[model samples]
Target chain A: MTEFIPPGTRFHPLPSPFPMKRGGALVGAHVAFETWGELNAARDNAVLIVTGLSPDAHAAANEGNPEAGWWEPMLGPGKPIDTDRWFVVCVNSLGSCKGSTGPASMNPSTGALYRLDFPDLSVEDGADAAASVVRGLGITRLACLIGNSMGGMTALSLLQRHPGIAHAHINISGAPRALPFSIAIRSLQREAIRLDPNWNHGQYDEVTYPESGMRMARKLGVITYRSALEWDGRFGRVRLESDRPDEEPFGLEFQVESYLEGHARRFVRRFDPNCYLYLSRSMDWFDLGPDGLRQIHVDKVLAIGVHTDILFPLQQQQEIADGLREGGADATFLPLESPQGHDAFLVDIARFGPAVAGFLATL
Target chain B: MTEFIPPGTRFHPLPSPFPMKRGGALVGAHVAFETWGELNAARDNAVLIVTGLSPDAHAAANEGNPEAGWWEPMLGPGKPIDTDRWFVVCVNSLGSCKGSTGPASMNPSTGALYRLDFPDLSVEDGADAAASVVRGLGITRLACLIGNSMGGMTALSLLQRHPGIAHAHINISGAPRALPFSIAIRSLQREAIRLDPNWNHGQYDEVTYPESGMRMARKLGVITYRSALEWDGRFGRVRLESDRPDEEPFGLEFQVESYLEGHARRFVRRFDPNCYLYLSRSMDWFDLGPDGLRQIHVDKVLAIGVHTDILFPLQQQQEIADGLREGGADATFLPLESPQGHDAFLVDIARFGPAVAGFLATL
Candidate 1:
């Protein structure tokens, strides 16, 4: 059993000897979370925000850090996930490098960085840890749970593994299982990092991180996250940094190429390679259909899908709602029309905002 | 001007001091080409076959090497491109490593490998060389010109540059210009190769080729060549090598992963990395729309496109047919239904054979 006791704005250690899903266990696992608004005495207005593969607990701006959150558009005072009416708690997922217990964390037993020695993690473990954090905060139940991408998987896993934790759940652009196309994409990404000579088989030091491989991997990721239609409209055959006019005819001529490389270079600094491997694998291994949604205890479920999403296509989201409905649950399937594709939840705020806000309003 | 005096099954030298499109010139550049069947006395039944990236001059079996061709299903004595009625010649493109004058070819000026010193190549150059080969063979008029993917671009360039060489042209899944989406994909692929430490700035020896990066790039290419729907129906979520599989719960669990890796491994042996960079760049540089098809002198044009092709969509094919028709040439647009996507022309033989055969019969 895990227990979380939190003070201040940082992380809180989980109860000693936390067990993992696949074999092995973590002794001193800790979770980092950020809260918005005040928890009512009744503690029924608290909202839990689960994150995707790359984001941390910084879901919104608060007193500690005035910087806007990754989901700033949806988390402000009068936004879809309005902070004014609900207490929001966002946890930095387990097995991530952003202030969470992961490969970068020190092992309590060996006093060394866990690195590859870190135990394998699943969405179940992440849901359990987040639940522990919720319990540690003295909130017995949550008003709603919102998740996107990998977070969507975690939210569903949470409802399946520990029933009655959240009254309603919102899942966006996620899957019941990783499809073959997605698995192939992720496998290539991991190969990019593993093949980097400097990676030293995931043991590279700070001075010798596989920046080249990681950057390329990110470039590939950025391509898959968005749709070809989105790119055609945004960067259609336009040249970048062409003011000099005497540019070489051979390299980086298109604006989209420059955009991908620039974004990837920036990403290499903030993200950890080992954490990427761990989290990506966990997502691929995630499968909740086998357990069936009949056992889910949530009061309401809202599943949103983007028509252009190639990774977790609309069919997967429809499957989620269909399965839920077939199991006698109140499920609403919202199909979104947007060019943003898999990243629609993050980029096409105008479409996602009202849908989420209206649903939360009914609750 | 280029001159082809062929004595063997391999290559015919281009006219010495060949001029390039953007500037510069090659001293002793040559083209690799293979022919099937006999040339009629009138020498008017010759059909030129253009290829996509990575294919060689071998399009069908002949006396020299009786091995079946890459397009064996569509090439034979009575195939769509019948060897009995029409003499067929397939050219290994310029800037390719398959026995053609490319980055791997020796630079006569320096007696060293051209490597990065290879003159910037474009589709126009490929067309120019192909036209010379046709002239060298004493074929004053071609019965038909068949091309696919990059080959399609080359065939159109040939028509635009030197008209009246081919009476009819068939382009399959090729674009008039490289779209931003395709350019971005190609750019990332080049980055993967360039970032490999073993690449050594494209100067690595045979023993130190950047196999890992090339394999990853090929995997990415494979993903784009076919559709997600195709993978779903084919590999689904099947595990890789599952008999007594002590597989770590994380890496390469799907069968598609192993399929991609296997194909990539085999590809690395037959293809050169420098050639990939050169040819990919050449494709990006190809743009025939700016020059206009008003100058095209072909008698008939048939453009085929796959509905699911993300790289070169059906709309692009429609644009091609529209432009040709507007320019006073007889053009027909044929849309195919196949999950094979951009690669449908190569894989969906049943659909392609009838259409191509019917077109050839009409000619």
Candidate 2:
């Protein structure tokens, strides 16, 4: 499968033979990014936005791309991140198929898709790639680093590896390490994909693209992304208007089932399955240990989370704040009451936006 | 696949032309059951236990069956249910494969496995079947009715349809109706089974079974059965002692994944996938609605749930209690602080046992 890159995505060439965290190197690779607003004369106003698993670097419509990005509500000129005040640059993680070199990308050395041949991708490798991109943009130090979801893990890694790379940091809905429950969910997801005969050991083409596997995985993800309270409020016992005939058993019956099917159908073809497997496993392998946050030398840190997020519970955000505080950073932990769960940071912009903007203002 | 009946299960022949709730009739049908302790001449000391989707009639070892049953810890002589004082009868649900006439059973008219050809099975049908067994045993009324998990749904139906059938009811981790979240989860599970090529519209056999699909469905069920807090407490980030080789990219790496794998493997063949699909869908179709409980005429009701149960959840239990109370029954809602989630009633017997015993003692 070809990489699903969005239009107007910019690339930054990495140094040849870029060493990966888990004992392998990438050759002739590049990181994907998109920027809005301009860096100040001193490049001191630059802000970096690291994203979650599936989002591309096109965070918001800029001069080059006219399409609204995933986080458009919180990233435009007059929005929460406020591009007019902060020169925001969002980079797609290294192991994503969204205009970034990943398992779906063609290997320069062998002129073939990396697929399973790709080296083990760790969260730290993504941090290093983002760091390379920041450096490539000629920014010595960022005003603030913002990470959401998986990117939150990457931000912690970046701060620990490249000390003082940013003046401040905001970690949103991310954990210090992969919890067992989260690991189990992702493991079942991967199992769903691999169990699909169409997956065929990642050699699937568009014709045999493991659609059912991807659909199941995406449905499982959508289930976790939102809260049960929200589900009950939205579709409580609501059957579909056009329920299937009895002959076709297991057909869509409830509004929730239909909603999941529609969501999963839209996602299965849009994202590369191999890239998903790699990124998901990378999160499972991530752990900053107990004292890993003490290595980060940022001036201020804000860890934001929602109470309804079962995947990354509110306590994880508390842990991040407490860890950063122990590191002598002016840290604050803000737990929001949004009922959107793990995906609150993406959809509950009314709540997340103010917290982010307020933190950035303080920074 | 043959029915997986344990030894010493007794069958009660239903009236010929046994009508189902949704529409259809089973000819020469039988309901499976087992008895512990003797019923006094008055028959007022009789107690009935209806079970979840998977459990059989052998709820505990008796003179006929030495093998311990699913609820062995909470049932038997001098145990929580206390067969020493009250005669206990456990009946396998009509649509289950364990010694009951489910999709795996041979159709008397067709001389072939019913499979998908089986009529739509509703929770109400199971209630009617259980009611038949009770009436067959010459018990005009039960001293107490015990329902666990899906059995809770059946119990509610039985109480509503067969008014005054049980003087008291103890609903353990059951809901009045299926919630949207639970429906979505079960829908995905059914989809997993149907998507398997080996399933072949429920034409699977012992040699060509849909093992992978059943494995995925069972794993998903196991994941939801337990709470995230319990998972973290039990398997928190514990890696496997012998991790799989890198050649198998999606192989098990963590203890939680291994646990799910072991669990799914053990379950895939032990139960019929078609029966699982039928029973799962039946729950989705079960909703007693806002006033469904008002039809039940039990003297007292006890609804017990754990705080961490994601599948049935605590609110459902509260709803059951509140609805029963509204129906003029002396009802008590007991929410336990077990981290084991929906399966807590099965594993956390220390808490469940006493509450059950206390309720039965009052009855």
Collision count for each candidate, in order = 2, 0
Compared with the true structure, what per-residue lDDT tens digits does model 1 show for residues A135-201? 9999888999888899988988888887789988898997888888888888888888887777776
**What is chain B's TM-score across the candidates, in the order shown?**
0.95, 0.98
Clashing pairs in 2: none
Which candidate tops TM-score?
2
**What TM-score results for chain B when candidate 2 is compared with the true chain B?**
0.98
lDDT of 1 by residue, B224-303 (tens): 89988898899987776763253443456678888897789888757778888889888877778654765677779999
Native contacts matched by each model: 0.81, 0.79
Q: Can you write out model 2's per-residue Cα lDDT over A76-178, one digit (the tens) per residue?
A: 8888899899999999999899988999999888898999889999999999999999999999999999999999999999999998899999999988999
Top DockQ prediction, candidate number: 2
